[model samples]
Target: MNYLAHLFLAKDTPESLIGNLLGDFAKGSVKFLYTEEIRKGIELHRSVDTYTDSHPIFRASKRLIAQPRRKFSGILVDVFYDHFLARHWSEYSDVALEAFSSHVYKILVDNQAILPTSLLQIIPMMKAYDLLASYQEIGGIDNALRRIATRIRWQNNLADGIEDLIANYQQLEADFCAFFPELIDYAQTYCYQADRPLA
Candidate 1:
C-alpha cells in the first residue's frame, strides 16, 4: 500500500489520517512528538506495512518483476497495489475518488503544523496532480514511477517497473484482489495499542 491505500485504511478522522501518513517520516519513537491518537495511527501504519511486506501473496507478486529491476520490487509492488486500489475504488468505498482525494489533501493542509517538513513540501504537487485519484490510470502510475526513479540516488531503472506490471497485469491484479481483502480484515481488527481499536 502507498498513500491512497494507507489513507483508505485509516479510521475516518483527521488525526488518524495524519498519523498513518506520518509513518513514512516519523521513524523510531513518536512518544513525545505527537498526540496519543496520532501515535496509534502511526503504529497502525507500521503494522500494515509489516503485514503487507511479509504476506505470501505479496511475495508472489514480487517474483513477477524482471531481474534487472528486482532490487526495487517492493517499491514497484507497493505502487502497483495502489494502482489497483484506485482502479477499483468503488468496490471498497462509497466516496468518489476525486472527492476522497480532495478531502485528504485538505486534512493534510489544515493540519500542516503537526506534519513533518518532508510531507509539507509535497502537498502542492500532491493536490496539483491529484495523485491519489490518478493512480487509476497506467499512465499516471508510469509518471509516478518515473518521478520515483529520479529520486533514487543510484543509477537505476525503477521506471521500467511499469513494464513488469504491464506484462503481469492480470496476474498481479488477481494477487491484489486476493491479498487486499485479507489485509483489510487484519487492519480492521488490529489494535494500535493494547486498548485502542483501529476504528
Candidate 2:
C-alpha cells in the first residue's frame, strides 16, 4: 500500500491522515509524539504494509515485474496499485475522487504545524502537483517512479519497469481488485480496535 491506500484506510480525521502519511517519513519512537488515535494510525500504516507484503495475491503481482527489475518490484507494485485504485475510485468509495483528494489535502494543510519536517516539505509539493488524483494516469505513475528512482541510492532502472506495468495491466488490476477489499476490511477492524473516536 502507498499514500492513497494508507489514507483510504485511515479514519477520516486530520490526526489519522497525518499519522498514516507519516508512516513513511517518521521512524522509531515517534509514536510518543502523537495522541493515541494518531499513533494507531501510524500502526495501521505498518499493519497495512505487513498485510500487503505477506498476502499471496500481492505476491502474484510482483512476479509480473520483469526479473531485472525484481529488486524494485514491491515499489512498482505499490504505485501501480494506487493507479488502479484511482482509476476505479467509484467502485471503492461513494465520494468523488476529486472531492476525496481535496478533503485529504485540506487535512494535511490544516495540521501542518504538527507534521514532521519531511512531510511538511513534501506535502506542499503533493498538493501543488495534485499527485493523489493524478494517479489515474500512467504518465503520473511513470513520473512518480522516475522521481523515486532518482532518490534511490543505487543506479537502477526502476523507471523502465513502467513497461511491465503496462504489459501486465489487466492481470494486475484483477490482483488489486481481489486484494484491496480484504485490506479495507482488515484496516477497518484494526483501526476500530486501536483508535479512539474523534471528538
Candidate 3:
C-alpha cells in the first residue's frame, strides 16, 4: 500500500466496526509484513524504564521512539487526514475513493491491536459516508491524499531544520546538498506551510 493508504488504514478506519475485519486480514498480511514484531518493538521503545538489552528490533524501535520529532510529524499527518481528508470525501472519484477506503478499512481491521492510540482515536470520527453520499465526485481523493502525504514527508524533513548548518560543520556541505536537493525543497516547503509551533 502507498503511504497515504497506510496512514489512513493505520489511523482512520472505525475500530468497532473494523475490528474483526482487521483480525482476518492480519492473519495473512500482518505476519508477512512482520507488523507484530515491529509493533512490539515500538511498544517496548515507548516505555522509557525498559532496558535496551532485548533484541535488534527492540533496539531499533527505541531509536525510532527516541526521535520524538518523527513521532510528532506522524501525529500531524493523522490530524490532517482525520480533520481534512475524511470530511471532504465527496470531492473524490467514486471508484478511487471506494478503493482507497476499502484498502484502508482492511488494513485497519488487520492491524487493529498494534496501532497507536493517537491513530485509533481518529477512526471513529471519520466522515466518509456523509461525504460520499452527497456528491458525484471525480478525482479529488487521489489528489488530496497524495498532497497530504507529500506535505507530511516535507514536514518530517523540516523537523531536522539544521540540515545546512550540520552539513557545513560536518565538512560535507557540497556533497550533502548535491545528494538531497528534493529533501531541501521539502524542508523549505514545510517551513512555509506549517502553522503550528515546531519542535
Candidate 4:
C-alpha cells in the first residue's frame, strides 16, 4: 500500500496517521522509538503491507503490468491502487478527498517533532503538492513515478510505468475495488485491537 491507503487504513487520529507513514520511514527495532499507540500504528501498517503483498488479488494485479516494468510491478501496483482509491474516494469515506488530505497534512505538521527525519524532509513538498489529493489525477501519479525513478541510483524504467497503468487500467481498477474492501476489514480489526483501553 501507498501513503493514501496506509493513512486511510489507520485509525483516524493524529498518532495513527503519523505512525502509518512511519512504517515507510522508520527502520529496525522501534521498541523505544515511539509511544505505544504510535508503535501499534506502525505495526498495523506493516501488517497491512504483508497482507496486501500476499493477497491473490493483489498478486494478480501485479501481473497486469507488462514487461520491462514487470520487474517493478509491486511498486507500480501500489501507486495505481492509490490512484484508484483517490479517484473513488467517496466510495470509502464521507469526507471530501481534498478535505481529508488537508486533515492528514495538519496532523503531520502538528506532530513534526516526533516524525522521522526522512518524513520531515518531504513533508513540505507533500503538503505543497497536495500529493494525497493529487493522486486522483493521472498526471500526479506520473510525476510521483518519475520522482521515485529519480531516487534510484541505477538506471531503471520505472519512469515509464505509467504505460502499464494506462494499458491495464480497467483490470487494475477492478483489482483495487475487489481487494480494498478486504483490506479495510483487516485494518479495522487491527484498529479495534489497537484501540482497546488498558484494563
Candidate 3 local lDDT, 143-164, one digit each (tens):
3333344546354433342222
Name model 3 segments beyond 4 Å from true.
1-95, 127-199
lDDT of each: 0.91, 0.88, 0.34, 0.90
| Candidate 4 lDDT (Cα, 0 to 1) | 0.90
Which residue pairs collide, candidate 4? none
| Candidate 2 Cα misplacement greater than 4 A, ranges | 195-199
TM-score of each: 0.95, 0.94, 0.25, 0.95
Best first by TM-score, ranked: 4, 1, 2, 3
Order of the predicted models by lDDT, top scorer first: 1, 4, 2, 3
lDDT of 3 at 103: 61
lDDT of 1 at 44: 90
Candidate 2: 10-residue stretch with minimal lDDT: 190-199
Model 3 RMSD in Å is 16.6
Instruction: Please give the lDDT score for candidate 3.
Output: 0.34
Clashes per prediction?
A: 0, 0, 3, 0
Q: What is the lDDT of candidate 1?
A: 0.91
- Give the per-residue Cα lDDT of candidate 4 at 195: 55
Q: For model 2, how does the per-residue alpha-carbon lDDT over 75-129 read when each residue is reduced to its tens digit?
A: 9999999999999999988999888898999988888878888788778778888
